[model samples]
Target: MNRVPVSSSNLSSVGYDESNQVLEIEFHGGRVYQYFDVPQRIHQELMNAGSHGKYFHRNIEDKYRYDQVK
Candidate 1:
Protein backbone atom coordinates (compact mmCIF):
# COMPACT_ATOMS: atom_id res chain seq x y z
CA MET A 1 0.00 0.00 0.00
CA ASN A 2 1.12 3.52 -0.81
CA ARG A 3 0.38 6.05 1.92
CA VAL A 4 -0.79 9.51 0.95
CA PRO A 5 -0.45 12.53 3.18
CA VAL A 6 -3.70 14.24 4.01
CA SER A 7 -4.79 17.55 5.48
CA SER A 8 -6.19 16.83 8.89
CA SER A 9 -5.29 17.93 12.37
CA ASN A 10 -5.97 14.49 13.80
CA LEU A 11 -4.43 12.49 10.99
CA SER A 12 -1.05 12.40 9.34
CA SER A 13 -1.60 10.10 6.37
CA VAL A 14 -3.74 7.32 4.99
CA GLY A 15 -3.33 4.22 2.84
CA TYR A 16 -5.47 1.44 1.53
CA ASP A 17 -4.78 -2.02 0.13
CA GLU A 18 -7.71 -2.85 -2.05
CA SER A 19 -6.86 -6.46 -2.65
CA ASN A 20 -6.68 -7.10 1.07
CA GLN A 21 -9.35 -4.67 2.09
CA VAL A 22 -7.14 -3.03 4.66
CA LEU A 23 -7.07 0.65 5.53
CA GLU A 24 -3.98 2.12 7.12
CA ILE A 25 -4.02 5.34 9.08
CA GLU A 26 -1.26 7.39 10.62
CA PHE A 27 -2.16 9.81 13.35
CA HIS A 28 -0.61 13.12 14.34
CA GLY A 29 1.34 11.80 17.31
CA GLY A 30 3.16 9.09 15.32
CA ARG A 31 0.68 6.34 15.86
CA VAL A 32 -0.07 3.98 12.97
CA TYR A 33 -2.94 1.56 12.61
CA GLN A 34 -4.36 -0.77 9.99
CA TYR A 35 -8.07 -1.33 9.87
CA PHE A 36 -9.09 -4.59 8.24
CA ASP A 37 -12.03 -5.66 6.15
CA VAL A 38 -12.82 -2.15 5.05
CA PRO A 39 -14.64 -1.48 1.85
CA GLN A 40 -13.21 0.66 -0.95
CA ARG A 41 -16.27 2.92 -0.82
CA ILE A 42 -15.56 3.79 2.77
CA HIS A 43 -11.96 4.57 1.94
CA GLN A 44 -12.98 6.87 -0.88
CA GLU A 45 -15.46 8.70 1.32
CA LEU A 46 -12.84 9.19 3.97
CA MET A 47 -10.47 10.67 1.45
CA ASN A 48 -13.06 13.07 0.06
CA ALA A 49 -14.52 14.12 3.40
CA GLY A 50 -14.09 17.75 4.50
CA SER A 51 -12.78 16.50 7.81
CA HIS A 52 -10.80 13.30 7.77
CA GLY A 53 -10.89 12.99 11.54
CA LYS A 54 -14.63 13.42 11.65
CA TYR A 55 -15.19 10.91 8.89
CA PHE A 56 -13.00 8.38 10.60
CA HIS A 57 -14.72 8.72 13.96
CA ARG A 58 -18.20 8.59 12.50
CA ASN A 59 -17.62 5.81 10.00
CA ILE A 60 -14.55 3.77 10.79
CA GLU A 61 -13.40 3.97 14.41
CA ASP A 62 -14.32 0.77 16.26
CA LYS A 63 -16.30 -0.34 13.22
CA TYR A 64 -13.69 -2.76 11.92
CA ARG A 65 -10.89 -4.99 13.15
CA TYR A 66 -7.61 -3.14 13.54
CA ASP A 67 -4.00 -3.51 14.54
CA GLN A 68 -1.46 -0.94 15.61
CA VAL A 69 1.46 -0.84 13.16
CA LYS A 70 3.53 1.69 15.04
Candidate 2:
Protein backbone atom coordinates (compact mmCIF):
# COMPACT_ATOMS: atom_id res chain seq x y z
CA MET A 1 0.00 0.00 0.00
CA ASN A 2 1.15 3.48 -0.75
CA ARG A 3 1.31 5.95 2.10
CA VAL A 4 1.14 9.70 2.09
CA PRO A 5 2.45 12.14 4.62
CA VAL A 6 -0.19 14.06 6.53
CA SER A 7 0.49 16.80 9.01
CA SER A 8 -2.24 18.36 11.07
CA SER A 9 -2.16 21.52 13.09
CA ASN A 10 -4.01 19.72 15.85
CA LEU A 11 -2.11 16.47 15.82
CA SER A 12 1.09 15.37 17.46
CA SER A 13 1.51 12.54 14.99
CA VAL A 14 0.09 11.73 11.59
CA GLY A 15 -0.23 8.66 9.36
CA TYR A 16 -1.65 8.14 5.92
CA ASP A 17 -2.72 5.47 3.41
CA GLU A 18 -2.13 6.73 -0.11
CA SER A 19 -3.96 3.84 -1.72
CA ASN A 20 -7.12 4.70 0.15
CA GLN A 21 -6.33 8.33 0.78
CA VAL A 22 -6.88 7.94 4.48
CA LEU A 23 -5.23 9.92 7.22
CA GLU A 24 -4.67 8.82 10.78
CA ILE A 25 -3.90 11.14 13.62
CA GLU A 26 -2.68 10.70 17.16
CA PHE A 27 -3.37 13.29 19.78
CA HIS A 28 -1.57 14.10 23.03
CA GLY A 29 -3.79 12.37 25.57
CA GLY A 30 -3.84 8.96 23.93
CA ARG A 31 -6.47 9.93 21.42
CA VAL A 32 -6.36 8.27 18.01
CA TYR A 33 -8.50 8.75 14.91
CA GLN A 34 -8.78 8.09 11.20
CA TYR A 35 -10.10 10.58 8.74
CA PHE A 36 -11.32 9.11 5.43
CA ASP A 37 -11.86 10.70 2.05
CA VAL A 38 -10.40 13.87 3.52
CA PRO A 39 -11.55 16.77 1.38
CA GLN A 40 -9.10 19.21 -0.14
CA ARG A 41 -10.52 22.01 1.99
CA ILE A 42 -9.66 20.17 5.18
CA HIS A 43 -6.31 19.09 3.80
CA GLN A 44 -5.45 22.66 2.97
CA GLU A 45 -6.63 23.74 6.38
CA LEU A 46 -4.27 21.27 7.94
CA MET A 47 -1.32 22.28 5.78
CA ASN A 48 -1.68 26.03 5.48
CA ALA A 49 -1.66 27.01 9.11
CA GLY A 50 1.04 29.41 10.23
CA SER A 51 1.48 27.36 13.35
CA HIS A 52 0.57 23.92 12.06
CA GLY A 53 2.14 22.08 14.93
CA LYS A 54 0.59 24.38 17.50
CA TYR A 55 -2.82 24.24 15.87
CA PHE A 56 -2.80 20.46 16.10
CA HIS A 57 -1.57 20.54 19.67
CA ARG A 58 -4.33 22.91 20.71
CA ASN A 59 -7.17 21.35 18.71
CA ILE A 60 -6.67 17.59 18.49
CA GLU A 61 -3.91 16.37 20.71
CA ASP A 62 -5.34 14.32 23.56
CA LYS A 63 -8.78 14.45 22.01
CA TYR A 64 -8.98 11.61 19.49
CA ARG A 65 -7.15 9.00 17.40
CA TYR A 66 -7.58 6.96 14.25
CA ASP A 67 -10.15 4.16 14.07
CA GLN A 68 -10.73 1.81 11.15
CA VAL A 69 -13.45 2.85 8.79
CA LYS A 70 -16.07 0.56 7.31
Candidate 3:
Protein backbone atom coordinates (compact mmCIF):
# COMPACT_ATOMS: atom_id res chain seq x y z
CA MET A 1 0.00 0.00 0.00
CA ASN A 2 1.12 3.54 -0.74
CA ARG A 3 0.80 5.78 2.29
CA VAL A 4 0.58 9.56 2.04
CA PRO A 5 2.29 11.59 4.71
CA VAL A 6 -0.01 13.71 6.85
CA SER A 7 0.42 16.60 9.23
CA SER A 8 -0.40 14.94 12.52
CA SER A 9 1.50 14.78 15.77
CA ASN A 10 0.64 11.11 16.20
CA LEU A 11 0.04 9.81 12.72
CA SER A 12 2.75 9.91 10.13
CA SER A 13 0.84 8.69 7.07
CA VAL A 14 -2.27 6.85 5.96
CA GLY A 15 -3.18 4.39 3.24
CA TYR A 16 -6.19 2.44 2.20
CA ASP A 17 -6.85 -0.65 0.13
CA GLU A 18 -10.42 -0.33 -0.99
CA SER A 19 -10.53 -3.65 -2.75
CA ASN A 20 -9.73 -5.44 0.49
CA GLN A 21 -11.14 -2.86 2.85
CA VAL A 22 -7.93 -2.40 4.71
CA LEU A 23 -6.88 0.85 6.37
CA GLU A 24 -3.21 1.35 7.07
CA ILE A 25 -1.82 3.94 9.44
CA GLU A 26 1.74 4.73 10.31
CA PHE A 27 2.46 6.56 13.52
CA HIS A 28 5.12 9.14 14.27
CA GLY A 29 6.73 6.64 16.56
CA GLY A 30 7.26 4.33 13.54
CA ARG A 31 4.52 1.89 14.47
CA VAL A 32 2.41 0.72 11.55
CA TYR A 33 -0.99 -0.93 11.83
CA GLN A 34 -3.57 -2.16 9.36
CA TYR A 35 -7.21 -2.23 10.29
CA PHE A 36 -9.38 -4.83 8.61
CA ASP A 37 -12.87 -4.41 7.16
CA VAL A 38 -12.73 -0.64 7.04
CA PRO A 39 -15.04 1.19 4.69
CA GLN A 40 -13.72 3.82 2.31
CA ARG A 41 -16.00 6.40 3.83
CA ILE A 42 -14.33 5.98 7.19
CA HIS A 43 -10.95 6.34 5.56
CA GLN A 44 -12.04 9.56 3.88
CA GLU A 45 -13.41 10.94 7.11
CA LEU A 46 -10.17 10.20 8.89
CA MET A 47 -8.22 11.99 6.21
CA ASN A 48 -10.51 15.00 6.37
CA ALA A 49 -10.91 15.21 10.14
CA GLY A 50 -9.55 18.19 12.08
CA SER A 51 -7.50 15.84 14.20
CA HIS A 52 -6.60 12.46 12.79
CA GLY A 53 -5.36 11.12 16.09
CA LYS A 54 -8.45 12.20 17.96
CA TYR A 55 -10.73 10.82 15.29
CA PHE A 56 -8.91 7.54 15.39
CA HIS A 57 -9.27 7.30 19.13
CA ARG A 58 -12.95 8.17 19.14
CA ASN A 59 -14.10 6.29 16.06
CA ILE A 60 -11.55 3.78 14.92
CA GLU A 61 -9.38 2.61 17.76
CA ASP A 62 -10.39 -0.84 19.00
CA LYS A 63 -13.35 -0.73 16.64
CA TYR A 64 -11.94 -3.06 14.00
CA ARG A 65 -9.76 -6.09 13.72
CA TYR A 66 -6.14 -5.03 13.15
CA ASP A 67 -2.60 -6.16 12.84
CA GLN A 68 0.68 -4.54 13.62
CA VAL A 69 2.39 -4.32 10.28
CA LYS A 70 5.65 -2.93 11.54
Candidate 4:
Protein backbone atom coordinates (compact mmCIF):
# COMPACT_ATOMS: atom_id res chain seq x y z
CA MET A 1 0.00 0.00 0.00
CA ASN A 2 1.49 3.31 -1.01
CA ARG A 3 1.28 6.19 1.45
CA VAL A 4 0.81 9.53 -0.21
CA PRO A 5 0.93 12.72 1.85
CA VAL A 6 -2.05 14.98 2.25
CA SER A 7 -1.74 18.72 1.71
CA SER A 8 -3.17 21.02 4.43
CA SER A 9 -3.41 24.19 2.39
CA ASN A 10 -6.79 25.91 2.25
CA LEU A 11 -6.42 26.05 -1.54
CA SER A 12 -7.12 22.33 -1.54
CA SER A 13 -8.48 19.70 0.78
CA VAL A 14 -7.90 16.17 -0.37
CA GLY A 15 -7.06 12.80 1.16
CA TYR A 16 -5.47 9.74 -0.29
CA ASP A 17 -5.61 6.16 0.96
CA GLU A 18 -2.68 4.21 -0.37
CA SER A 19 -4.08 0.85 0.65
CA ASN A 20 -6.83 1.18 -1.95
CA GLN A 21 -5.31 3.87 -4.14
CA VAL A 22 -8.31 6.06 -3.57
CA LEU A 23 -8.24 9.84 -3.67
CA GLU A 24 -10.85 11.88 -1.88
CA ILE A 25 -11.22 15.50 -2.86
CA GLU A 26 -13.38 18.29 -1.51
CA PHE A 27 -13.96 21.04 -4.02
CA HIS A 28 -14.84 24.67 -3.46
CA GLY A 29 -18.51 24.10 -4.18
CA GLY A 30 -18.69 21.52 -1.42
CA ARG A 31 -18.65 18.81 -4.06
CA VAL A 32 -16.56 15.77 -3.41
CA TYR A 33 -14.92 13.11 -5.57
CA GLN A 34 -13.17 9.84 -5.01
CA TYR A 35 -10.57 9.05 -7.62
CA PHE A 36 -9.31 5.53 -8.08
CA ASP A 37 -6.01 4.19 -9.38
CA VAL A 38 -4.51 7.66 -9.37
CA PRO A 39 -0.75 7.85 -9.69
CA GLN A 40 1.21 9.65 -6.99
CA ARG A 41 2.68 12.14 -9.45
CA ILE A 42 -0.73 13.08 -10.79
CA HIS A 43 -1.99 13.55 -7.28
CA GLN A 44 0.90 15.84 -6.50
CA GLU A 45 0.30 17.75 -9.72
CA LEU A 46 -3.32 18.19 -8.79
CA MET A 47 -2.42 19.54 -5.38
CA ASN A 48 0.20 21.83 -6.82
CA ALA A 49 -2.12 23.43 -9.33
CA GLY A 50 -2.33 27.20 -9.07
CA SER A 51 -6.07 26.74 -8.79
CA HIS A 52 -6.14 23.44 -7.02
CA GLY A 53 -9.78 23.60 -5.98
CA LYS A 54 -11.04 24.76 -9.35
CA TYR A 55 -8.76 22.50 -11.34
CA PHE A 56 -9.98 19.50 -9.41
CA HIS A 57 -13.54 20.30 -10.32
CA ARG A 58 -13.03 21.46 -13.88
CA ASN A 59 -10.39 19.04 -15.01
CA ILE A 60 -10.38 16.05 -12.72
CA GLU A 61 -13.84 15.76 -11.20
CA ASP A 62 -16.25 13.85 -13.37
CA LYS A 63 -13.93 14.30 -16.31
CA TYR A 64 -10.35 13.20 -16.17
CA ARG A 65 -9.33 10.37 -13.91
CA TYR A 66 -11.98 10.82 -11.23
CA ASP A 67 -15.65 10.18 -10.66
CA GLN A 68 -18.28 11.96 -8.67
CA VAL A 69 -18.63 11.13 -4.99
CA LYS A 70 -21.29 8.59 -4.18
Off by over 4 Å in 2: 1-10, 39-48, 53-70
Tens digits of per-residue lDDT, candidate 3, 1-70, equal 9999988999999999999999999999899999999999999999999999999999899999999989
Give all candidates' CA lDDT scores: 0.97, 0.55, 0.96, 0.63
TM, every model:
0.97, 0.47, 0.97, 0.55
Q: What would the per-residue lDDT of candidate 2 be over residues 1-70, giving only the tens digit for each residue?
A: 2223445434555555656656666655546667666544444555566776775555544544446432
Where in model 4 is the C-alpha error above 4 Å? 1-12, 57-59, 63-70
Candidate order (lDDT): 1, 3, 4, 2
Q: Which residue runs of candidate 1 sit more than 4 Å off their true CA positions? A: none
Worst 10 residues of 1 by lDDT: 1-10
| lDDT at 8, model 1 | 98
Candidates in order: C-alpha RMSD to true structure: 0.6, 5.9, 0.5, 4.8
What is the C-alpha lDDT profile of model 1 across 34-55, one tens digit per residue?
9999999999999999999999
Please say which candidate is ahead in TM-score: 2 or 3. Answer: 3
Q: In angstroms, how far off is 4's CA in candidate 4?
A: 12
Superposed by TM-score, candidate 4 places the C-alpha of residue 10 at a distance from the truth, in angstroms, of 11
Error of 3 at 12 (Å): 0.3
Winner by TM-score between candidate 2 and candidate 1: 1
